[model samples]
Target: MATGVMTPDERAFRGDLRKAPFMLGELEGRWKLESLEWPNALIDVTARDGLPYRLRFDLTNYPAAPPTARLWSRVENAALAPGLFPRSITGSGRVKDVFRTDWMNGTALYLPCDRTALAGHESWLQQMPSKRWQPSVGITHYLELVHELLNCPDYAPPAGA
Candidate 1:
């Protein structure tokens, strides 16, 4: 049932999962944990306007460096409209398109932009408690912040704001 030999990071990830089992729940209209691959976890959520999306959390160096979140699934016109969705932030604090569409499949993982005119902003990821992350913060807290960002319009900065 387990995949190959577990790395120390994987073991830590499992321990974190155990400490926050509720993070995996499907509580009707809420984000649900889909799959977990050691330092990466996938979550499914429906945007406020009813668009479905997948969120990937990369937990490598977690608790030290905040997890990097990437949006997944096809982008809807509404989702791409200026202030509708989250955007990705560069390491230098600049905003960048979340997906590199030109890359080959699997090689390039990003939100689909067929219908969107603007890239969504990633206020939540950028504002994550990176400087404040501690062993006690855990994934549950991180995900709760994500839920707030997606469902609570006021939580995310208006695109370009």
Candidate 2:
């Protein structure tokens, strides 16, 4: 475990991790947690198709404030053909376009992990059957949700699809 002074919530979260070793093992098998801060955890998980991906979880206000998940990867945009000179020299000019050229490197998606009303803005963790999060729900439930999300067709796009 990472050593440092922990807040009440952080302590609770750690307790959850300890209480559910099996669940933790499942997550570890899939998304290996690399590091853990009081409010942040860095994890590397293999996509269903075996593509490795990194995820950053912001658990600062956890429970009350859903952890924010960001896809941290430098995937080359397949939409752009190889050797095709980018129309925008600085890459900034392509910001208006639907397909981002700079997506070849840096963050790709800002997952909405909250229960927002906006379409496509809802998170699997905050969706049906799993949306009933309570104070008692611990890291196990969250990890299970992550597992489901990684396997769900609607949540996780088919590899290279």
Candidate 3:
């Protein structure tokens, strides 16, 4: 959905998917650190399935009104230190900009975090509002909503749905 049309409340409630287990996949490999762009971050892509590669202009963030998550992927079998994932730029607070994902550079999936309330709703509510729940679900929500949006049987918009 366009950022302008989807109310913050609607955006919050759009996805209802459940969280999947963190997949430790082919992304595990040596990747280089690049740079950070405001909407997009930068990281060097070392290997997709063990070949040299990199994506300079391609990175993604969450779709929430105020996105909170940095990019993340899983790396396996590579020799780095322990406690490294959290310490990596893609992990916790080391720097807001520089980061890396655990996954290598094959099929890249950028997922967003739920940090802001539904767009059109107030930050807080006194009673359970009659409008769409506008509640926050995690990445799963985005996944579910993406599926729904893709296979929408009825092209009708949510009617106070």
Candidate maximizing lDDT: 1
Q: Per lDDT, what order, best first?
A: 1, 2, 3
Clashes of each: 3, 0, 16
TM-score for all predictions? 0.51, 0.53, 0.22
lDDT of 2 by residue, 1-161 (tens): 54676777777766766665535654567656666766876665554555444555666656665554444433441222322211223333321121122443322222233322113544444555344344466444545545554544433332243
* Candidate 3 weakest ten by summed lDDT: 17-26
Which digits, one per residue and each the tens of the lDDT, describe model 1 over residues 1-161?
Answer: 46588766666666776663444535555667778876778766654545555666777765544465556533441112334344343221112233332323222223221112112424433553352334565665545544544555333332553
- Error in Å for residue 99 of model 3: 30
Model 3 global lDDT (CA atoms, 0 to 1): 0.29
Off by over 4 Å in 3: 1-117, 123-137, 155-161
Model 1, residue 47: displacement in angstroms?
A: 3.6
Clashes of 2: 0
- Residue 139 lDDT in candidate 3: 33
Give the lDDT of residue 22 in candidate 1: 44
Q: What's the candidate order when arranged by decreasing TM-score? A: 2, 1, 3
